[model samples]
Target: MGDFIDVEQLYDLAMTYSVKLLQALLLLIIGLIIIKRLTSFLRKRFERRKLDPSVRSFLLPGISLSLKILLGISIATMLGAEMTSFVAIIGSIGFAVGLALQGSLANFAGGLLILVLKPYKVGDYIETKDHSGTVNEIQIFYTTLDTPDNKRVIIPNKELSNSSLINYSINKTRRVDFKFGISYDDDIKLVKDILNNIVSSHSLIIQEPEPKIVIGEHGDNAIIFYVRVWCKREDYWTIFYELQERVKLDFDQNNINIPYPQMDVHVSNS
Candidate 1:
């Protein structure tokens, strides 16, 4: 009889633990679903706010991880596990992992600075060191660029943040500077008039700032005329190539001489 009573108590104990375990599992499953939905909601909110891509990329993962950690703690508590020791162990592990990833930590910090400071953003044409391209993506550790020739470049965020970079797309307009050389004997007035006409005729060039055509310098073989014009950033390359071709063609048609280096050497033997 006593053995039967003991068996009944044992079964009750096992049943109680089984129920708690199932409850813990259910809580974990529901918690994960909530975390996923919450993270997605936050991501959409960030997109609506027009947050920087880098910031959004860094933040979403962090939010998910933080929520999961909290959920894990809650699950452990529900399972009758001690919280203090579990948190301490987690902290120790995190510290050890952080110590092992110093370089990665620096990159993470650099990425944060880039997002906050707004040095460059996705779709911006940027040049850093010797690499120049359009920024395609910015992540926690690297920035991806699409080069003019369709090459993909991956630059480390740490190096990019520390170095100087030129963001060419920051402004809506750009100035195109061209230097043309003509023979020293060429008529200065005629050259200026020809350039002015070309500038006025070009549909891409802006007239508000006014195109500048002036004698810049006198070289050994030619006179240099500096030409400056403003155009929309999108039209810069087109205008540059067109201007050069048109100027050369017009100069040739008008009988203007573009001087090249020539040496007249005479030797006398006595």
Candidate 2:
């Protein structure tokens, strides 16, 4: 009779524990479901804001991980596990990982700053001390570039953030300056007229600013003419090359001489 009474008590104990276990499982499932829904909602919200791709990519994963971690702690608490040790273990692990990946963490922070500050964006042509190219992609740790020679460059986010860079595509228009040297005997007024005609006839040049032609300097063998013009960024290179070719051809046809550097030396017996 005593053994039967002990068995009944053992059965009641197992039942009570089984109920707690089931409750814990149910809470875990519900928490996971909520986390998934919330993460999805936040992702859609980010899309609605039209956030930068790099920023969105970085934020979504972080948000999801944070939410999942909170859910895990909640499930652990539901199971009546001691919170103190769990928290300590998590803290220790985080500290160790942080120490091991200090450089990576700095890069991640720099990337976040880049996305928020808007120094340059994809498709912009940028020049830094190390590289110059069009920005192809912006990742969490690195920024990719496509060079003019058809090479790919990967620059660390930390380095990029720490240095100065020039973004050429930020402005819609750019000024193109050219210096041309002609023989001192060449007529300045005639040369100016020819240059004005050349600039005015170019389809790519912006007329609003008005192309400038000025006598810049007198060199030892030649007179330098400075030409300044404005054009759309995309047309800059085309106009640059075409203008040089046209000026050379025009000078040849107009009997203008572009002099070369020459030195006159005299020696007397001492």
Candidate 3:
């Protein structure tokens, strides 16, 4: 050995390691704070400008996460680690992770499609093969739904996108279709007049379509009529239920017979 260990060299080594550790810690903390602030700022700016909630909710988290990841790698490089191999190492590890999380990646892709295509939005009453409910939240991996009976449903985004979605609440107005059957003996014109009056006088019905009540079909037992009315979306269910009740009451009061199928049987005696 050329010489014994010196206190000065040990002191310098300790000082160097301390400085590196401190720098790494400081850079990490600062980078995280900056990422947080930037994301918060972006979200507020979008919200203040009245941007769509879906856009804001999706973009902010993504931008923040990406920035933090990049900043962390930069800090790691500054702490005396060779970033060339580090980058390749991280890339390979990320590739393996991506393979492991294939389903999650697919869900994320589905979420992007949902956001872009806008098949449905929060609070929209949607029906799909997987489930039917009012959408409460649209997240990266899943979409949350609340059913009519107050049940919470969480469906994977991939499944939702793969199926047909019926978004009932997307528009401001909706048409309500109702069918009624009357005895063939009943006057068609009289039935039409009663139905028109009942539909037009309803509080929720819109007058623009003019409340159509038309003869639909002639069945064995009864003549069918179709009643269609347009109303605001919020009033759909209420108007639907009220119309059924009101129409029945009106038909009963006017002695209009609603016929049902009946058969007379004769037994042959031999």
- The CA lDDT at 158 in model 1 is 93
- Candidate 1: residue 67 lDDT (0-100): 94
lDDT of 3 by residue, 77-141 (tens): 88777989889989999999999999999998998999999998877899998679998888878
**lDDT for model 3:** 0.87
Off by over 4 Å in 3: 1-15, 260-270
CA displacement after TM-score superposition, residue 7 of candidate 3 (Å): 7.8
Error in Å for residue 229 of model 1: 1.0
Instruction: Give the distance in Å from residue 70's predicted Cα in candidate 3 to where it truly belongs.
Output: 1.8
Q: Write the per-residue lDDT of candidate 2 for residues 59-94, one digit (tens) a residue.
A: 776777888888888778777777998899889999
Off by over 4 Å in 2: 1-51, 54-87, 262-270
Top TM-score hit: 3
Q: TM-score for every candidate vs. truth?
A: 0.81, 0.72, 0.83
Q: Per-residue lDDT for 109-217 in model 1, tens only? A: 8888998898988889999997999999888888889999999999888999999999999999999999999997888899999999999999999998988999999
Better of 2 and 3 by TM-score: 3
Backbone clashes, candidate 2: 0
Query: For model 2, where is the 10-residue window of minimal lDDT?
Result: 52-61
Models sorted by TM-score, best on top:
3, 1, 2
